[model samples]
Target chain A: MFVDLLFNLRAQGLVVGVGEWTGFLDAVGRGLATDLDGMYHLGRALLCRSESDFDGFDLAFAKTFQGMEIADDLREKLEEWLRDAKERTEGERVPHEFESMEDLLEAFRDRLEKQKERHDGGNHWVGTGGTSPFGNSGRAANGIRVGGSAGGRSAVATAMERRWEGYRGDRTLDLRELKVVLRLLRSLAHDGPMELDLPGTIDATCHNAGDIELVEKRERRNRLKLVLLMDAGGSMAPHAERVEKLFSAASQMKDTFKSFEAYSFHNCVYQWLYKDIEQLDRVATSEILAKLTPQHRIILVGDASMAPYELFSSYSWPSTTTDAGIDWLRRIKQRSPAAIWLNPDPQRFWQHPTVSAIGRIFPMFDLSVQGLKDGIKKLRVPH
Target chain B: MAEFAQFSGTDRYIADEALMASVNAALVLERPLLVKGEPGTGKTLLAHAVAETLGRPLYSWHVKSTTKAEEGLYTYDVVQRLNDSRFGDADVSNIRNYIKYGPVGLAFDSDEPVVLLIDEVDKADIEFPNDLLRELDEMAFTVRELEETVRAKQRPLVIITSNAEKELPDAFLRRCVFHFIDFPDRERMERIVHVHLPTLGPDLMKAALDRFFAFRKVAGLRKPPSTSELVDWLTVLVASGLDPASITEGDPFLGVLFKGEADLAAAVDKRRGRKSW
Candidate 1:
């Protein structure tokens, strides 16, 4: 059974080699996994090294076990819904009847208990289609979707969420506009002691007609330090291209500062911030704060579009240190008074509850040339 | 293949059941284990713990942004060979004398199943992982300069860690087992703390944990205190002889707890009114 699965995975362009096959057999022989889920996890652990291969591995695994031959059939149905959803905005409604998520959740819980069998297209009960407050493929703008691709972005939550596409660091960005704005944040100080001026030495040497001459003088280095905190994953996926451009531009400003640090976070700043894309090691927020002085400028980049609960609720993220994202933002603001937030979400969507909530704490600008100019100008002002 | 019993006694690591299962699978399968996690969550430590448990010699390759995949196999010293030929030195015609074994090459040439750690692999270029695919899969590589193929006498237990700085190719990922190390919970964190500081007093430990958890609960912090930070704070607390009861008070030691200027200000602001300082 496992061999057949491995063969199928290889056929599907997974590149399962002889070594991996032998290892899979060894795992099964050793009884590392007893059940199907365990086997799935074991297979995934042994087979998939990167997150990009996860989607392919899932399809191959499902096809081999569930005996589903038509892989494209489900995707085609999903694609059809997506196409229809994009074209038809008539069925789009937020169901303003419920005042709060709590009330909707309470009603949803009752319907779930009353539901006895699989339901499809009805006014009530947890199933596909209709104006029901639960399940996928329905006109319920606030429904909780289960077991389908997110055709429409109306769901409060999802069961089978799509994998987050990792950010590509090598992508090229037109930094001309960004560099112009970033230059505003530059603050050069001549007070600090400097080393030998190489360019000055060469000029002086040439002036002396090939005579051995050297110039030793202090050169002004940019005293300003900029800390860029970027948001990644999920909602920020749509704005990746723009964010990459910003990242490329910001990274190029290394020569503009005595010290520059960039870190990536998901949704909100929490216990850990990734220093790099691979997210192998993280420098604690506390450590970052300690390392940077109050004089340093902090720039936050994100769409700031998530459930309000993620910002204010105590149980937003499991096993995290923070009770509320707002508190963290406030803390950051208090430390670095010059901190500014750059929202990739359009100015129209800045009125979003979460975005507005974040805006209240930090001065925000859109992720554009003008927005970046305004943000840099704001950073120049003394706190 | 080694039995499951051989890989036992990994209790010092404090890994969860799922993580342990992944490690076991990787060991049994003889495939490389690719571990990903946020920093300071013990991703690299897993490799060390596994190697220690298996009683295997560990070979580490710390990759930087400029690191090339060829450096892990073998490097031909063309300049040195040319210099030797120019100097009329002995064995100038022998190409094997100029070939130096890199970490991967060393691992393949090992007589036993050594543990190979490729730390922070995402630091390298996009093509780095793909370049290692054939060698990793076949456990061998041909040195074109020497005109000889070197095969592994014993398959090394490869461990690759990524910071998620870059996305690796799907083909490279499919060749290894994957595991993600989540941030340890309070209970697990307590165990980890005890492991590091066994001599910590009960009262101080309780107070410290309380303060740590409370500080972590504060929002909008760009970087929250991690497990290692907590340990570092405790080390400082023990060294300073500060009272744990006064931890909530505006103590200067808050610097150890919150590293960022903003985080420190927030911590100070949260405790007592702004004018109290």
Candidate 2:
């Protein structure tokens, strides 16, 4: 019965395997869940592994059990009212007529459709700022409010709210997480002071009939020099925070890298790269190119979105720079072969003219956690 | 099936319904419960609470950046044996004496069920979790040098906590029950704080919570103070004999709330009603 729910979870990009599925089924069969609420909590606890998957789990749940809760909730409320009515004394209670179950359901469905139509009409439903009877906090007699007042909406509607969307991992990089992923960009080589090799000392002692024989090995240290050229100003302003996080994380890794340098430029790299984002201090691009070697890895951060003339024209990005932006890019790439481009723009929008042009120059990835992971993997290999 | 003790939370820990369900599920399923959340959100404290409520002995293994997976199982003390033979008056004939068991091994070797807390597992290297997959799955490990396998007499309940310094492997994550403890809402936060400080005045509690939530909403805070910090700050407030109304005038004891210099500056700027930092 839950096989469709499993498929739906997979369709929503959750990593739900047979092991998790069986465990979920096991929990269910053990009588842990007796109602919709219990089952919802059980499925999430057993199947979802991270906060990122919670949003997807809620989606899959709402899809599988869409309208089931409406009837369940109505029955529960009716039963509750019936019990309340039973508690009242015979003299205090007034005689009431009830509609047939079918007619009651028919009226409920019609009212639901009318509520949705009013929602679509605007200014009369949940989406509008004005007071509407079918929405929350609206003042209308005998009007049913939806959401925010708990037990008033169906379970499916609550699940569809997707409250855990902020915790999704696909968004922009967090600061500490950025530092963690950037730690993998190191190329470790053993070249420092020796430390005692405990395992080898034990092996030598055991082989020599419990005789003491000390063994020592050199410690390993990261030996890669990293250069970060980030884009600033103009269209890059939207992505300034993300790029700054990347730059700050990389620059702060003093112990992880042999040397690290960061320079900023507007749009694309021209003849000059600024020492800071303010663009007050500038240095010729050729001087940096001359100082760099083939071994040094370069990471270029930018949105790579601009007019077509910005890359090919000499004075488009700025009137002062003499060389074309594309020429300076090729010179840097030629000088340091191990370089990659990190675009803050989503991959779907990479069809832009300038982003595509830069894509041919350097392998590009998004400026997200997963994208940075992929970029770090590519950076580790000697390109 | 054996009857397992369920954790309904202790007097100190205020776990929500979902968290309770997760702990119970993990207990019945006999899988490790991997609890993750922001720092100071009681990720590590959950293990202590579980151990106390279940009436089981607790074993803790604090992970560092250089910690290896093998250290959790058994460590061969070759140097000690060599020293005993060379300069010390001790028997070196039996290798078993030198095979000291780590936290996991100690938990497995215990006669009764125990709670093993691997605190901050993400502080170790990326491959740390994958290395223990086999031993964690089977609850057994073979001491290769001794040519003997150590199996659990009673499967110990394992609880792992991570601050998400790094992403854990998918295979390792799939074997455990995961839960993220969100920052408690205002009502829940008041209850949590009240649990820590019962004698706190209502007016002071109201003023402090208002200031705390307002400070948390200020833009560009590098690190926000959590529940534990709030409790500490309020304790200081009561001890200093400060008036509840004066709490709104300026941030007293700001150091107790904000640990980061950048966050402190931003908070101060916001309080002063500055347009820019």
Candidate 3:
């Protein structure tokens, strides 16, 4: 619905992006989000979010209103109707049709616990791990571990093995081991400062009545904020969408990070990235980029397509400026070992004179597409 | 309402059942249903059925670039509030009572289910969804000055439509059931035509549909005409007393369905050259 609302609004002229929608949802799940007006947060959320992506969103919307006279008439009609509603609500309460989000979660948890108890009472358990890619399946495997605790080395290994088994994916596994995989794949990863789940620590302290709702409803506090600077133009065009998809995937997938912010940089990063990619002021943006921390998991999106001698050739992206995007990248990676480059340009192309030239500057940049998932894997869980 | 129900029976068609189920369930669950599909797939009709079935007055909010959340909700009428404010203690309540429930408010107040149709929610800014989520989750909201929660007893069934431009974030996807409506198949399209245009002869309908599919096959159309458009155009042809002998006259009405000038020309040329499409 979020996607639906997004496109629907876009059709009408309001244009929210996937990033904003995610942030809004993150805000809602954690219960920190607020309403701006009666414009309909729920309505927008339910109908506008799309899984196939932002492609053709506007075209579809324009189709729905082909002979729509109602669009014009309804605006004023809606305002009048709203007036009538508040008028009716003057003295009494007008309870929302939907339950409290907190209440809904409570009910959902209760139903889940009931199912868990019934399942646990049976021969098999809703145990351990499984590959819960989108986390849409309620991610049900909480507590029925195969003689292990929730956090630890064994848990980690069990998770990896479970994922590995599923990775082969030819054969299906029993229920118990599947949960192990789900927890491994989707659970948030944290290592410092706001580290909610230590890399390998297990604390068996909890009240008996406590449930695993929090396990599914994650707080953004554990997220490791990343600032991605992708390179566009040139050979990067073909892989632009692919690189962005990875960025999109990582944006929603990574629990190790709080939030991910992305920017596009050409040959150098002397300044800040424009929030809107269309507008970038060299002097001011450079100053802003300088202020951003190098601690971000700065994954570069461009296919180092510059001339082989380009970096040493002495001309930066726009040239003659005091900014070196490659240098900022090297500095950022030094602070966070997780930084990696994603290029859709094939590896065979990597040895091409142009790529070879860029490679001389940044030797360890992995040049593979399938390696995208792997690179992101390294960023969050650490090799 | 009758126009559309009959229109559904026209010579042209769209296939949208999975979307129907999702929308139905969302309403049953009292959760909003978000529908994303191509431009001509009938996203708005689902909202129409909801309003028809539930007996709730339909409130349509067409999102625009400048659309602000504040505008969708209640706006203050200072004179009304101030005038009522002095009437008495009851009048104080009246000040807050300057009710003109917006679509969101109508969903909250109407004793009957109000279908709040946000026809195209994608036009707003990236912050739009976040802005709407709270009012949706709360069903009841606190207008800053009210110092109290204005809760809705009646929850409106929210129907949002979109064409997927990009993948929505997981956070946004979490709030409701999402569905994508596909274009209808040949058999269904024929059936739809029969339903909307019962008076049309079967052979003529089939011929018209054959041409419709042939036209849809040509790539590069911005958006193929919707069932409603096809039906409207066919009606125009039939009412104009167009003959199978002179199909060339239907060329002007082709604009209603095919936006591509080249495709339209090709389709027209194809029809003009043949006695039957």
Winning model by DockQ: 2
Q: Between prediction 2 and prediction 3, which has the larger lDDT?
A: 2
Candidate 1 residue-wise lDDT, B3-76, digit = tens: 45345436567776557678777777677788987777888888898899889999999999989999999987
iRMS of every model, one decimal? 10.9, 3.0, 19.8
- The CAPRI-style docking tier of model 3 reads incorrect
- True-contact fraction per candidate equals 0.43, 0.57, 0.10
Arrange candidates by lDDT, descending. 2, 1, 3
Over A192-220, each residue of candidate 1 has an lDDT whose tens digit, in order, gives: 67677775676565444345578777766
Better of 1 and 2 by DockQ: 2
**Residues A180-271, candidate 2, lDDT per residue (tens digit)?**
88888878899778999987887887778776789899888888899999999998888888998898888788668988999999889987
Worst 10 residues of 2 chain B by lDDT: B1-10
Model 3, position A153: C-alpha lDDT score: 26
Instruction: Give per-candidate clash totals.
Output: 29, 0, 98
Is candidate 1 or 3 superior in DockQ?
1
The residue ranges of model 1 lying beyond 4 angstroms of the native Cα positions read: A1-30, A40-383, B1-11, B82-90, B250-277
Model 1 fnat value: 0.43
